[model samples]
Target: MGCLSATRSKAIHKIDIPALDWPMARFPRYKYPLEDYVHENQQEDAKCLEETEDLIHKYNAAGKPVAAILVEPIQAEGGDNHASPEFFQGLQQIGKRTGAALLIDEVQTGGGPTGKMWCHEHFDLPEAPDIVTFSKKMLTGGYYFKEEFKPPQGYRIYNTWMGDPSKVIMLEEVIRVIQRDRLLENVNESGDILMKGLTTLQNQYPQHINSTRGRGTFIAFDGTNAAKRDSIVNKLKLQGIHSGGCGDKSVRLRPALIFQPHHANIFLNKLETVLSNL
Candidate 1:
């Protein structure tokens, strides 16, 4: 059996769980605004890539070869952390060299929120990942995989209660709706409004906010600290906006594909009110 391993990225929810004795490499903590910190972010990427390769090698030499490396295209629960396309491409190459299957977890970023069915599509990987997992908006939890990952025996993938097949029926209708309504296009349109509004808010309230980042409508911004973040979320909730916080002090925006430009405007106005009061 291969040794289990994981990345040391800030997937906040993992903090309370008992983890396996696996080697973990740091995820790049890029500085923002991304344009101004290009060179530094590049160096950060290089450093993380090096550490990942080192850990893979270290584990292999220890006789527990890593069989796979799993990652989120955008680290959603991890403060909406993002890595450049170059970073993802590099990671793919490293995984290939190390004989590790690259597994992308698209549970949060999938189903058109990032204006793509799969968030990793934006990375422009040379080829598809060896495995892709999805659930959330997908209507049912499942995965896709390259032939090599398939087990030779039947029942190997069984669970006590197979997920409802009825969900698949709903999933099919959901796909039809997305395509017929051009919801992906709506995602891009709404995303632009939200991103721009967040940027404006950050500029107007730099003391309270910073590090606004995301793609399509899958966005997030960090507060100066956790208390401020919670306060902002609470205020927004009172105003009828149901948003949430993640990764310690970041506020995340996970809107439905049906969310449109006008909806974004309402959200922006409410957000502005909350920030101004703060």
Candidate 2:
């Protein structure tokens, strides 16, 4: 149906057990801080885009046409890799020209984590993506698509459980609380603190960590190696600050939208302590 990273679908997950054989393309990997490596990162984007176009054309010629191209606003599992707005715009144009739907997977970057309800909003596409799939923090899993992408007949995309209606009620309450408390504003505020703190840490421990980057409460940095990254995560957990690692050596921070500046300060302090110990 759509070409997506194999990393997106857990092998153990039920629905993923019978996945289709779709063409896959490599997502770009950018250097950070993004501002400092703009030229190199732009080149990286161009290279990946070229590869994507080649894959589309090659697959079509082979008579196994790709119906959709799926991508994440931030490649969370693949190391928090991000593409520039221009890169995403070019992708949308390519998808349109090739008659393939562009699907933005916001499973990890949505619900205010990226300072937006949907991370794809930051891309400023000419029009909405053909489809947007979401889960994780949304408290449920589902997808939204344009009318043109709708199934031609009923039951084509139907599921027995569909989804739990009770989950919808809970999600509605969660939405209400988010709006009432203005959690999005809180995420932005805490994100600024986290980013600044991480930058400072990177500067202070250049030999141990580097490449600080993120948006809102979703932040990440690279440890010099996988072993060091695991040690840092384990040490942080012992210090009552749970963190996670991705793409071998990258440590990603997934704080709640309600996380405040003070919480960020606490995390930073604990993180610094762990670094000092290391």
Deviation (Å) of 14 in candidate 2? 11
- The reply for model 2, stretches above 4 Å from the true place, is 1-19, 161-163
Q: Residue 253 lDDT in model 2?
A: 93
TM-score of each: 0.92, 0.93
What TM-score does candidate 1 reach? 0.92
The residue-by-residue lDDT of candidate 1 on 164-260, one tens digit each, is 7788889999999999999999999999999999999999999888999988999999999999999999999999999989888999999999999
lDDT of 2 at 29: 86
Alpha-carbon RMSD to native, per candidate: 2.8, 2.5
Query: Candidate 2 on 112-179: residue-level lDDT in tens?
Result: 89878898888888899999988888899878889988879988877777777888899899889999
Error in Å for residue 266 of model 2 = 0.3
CA lDDT, every model vs. true structure: 0.88, 0.86
The parts of candidate 1 lying over 4 Å away from their true place are 1-19, 159-164
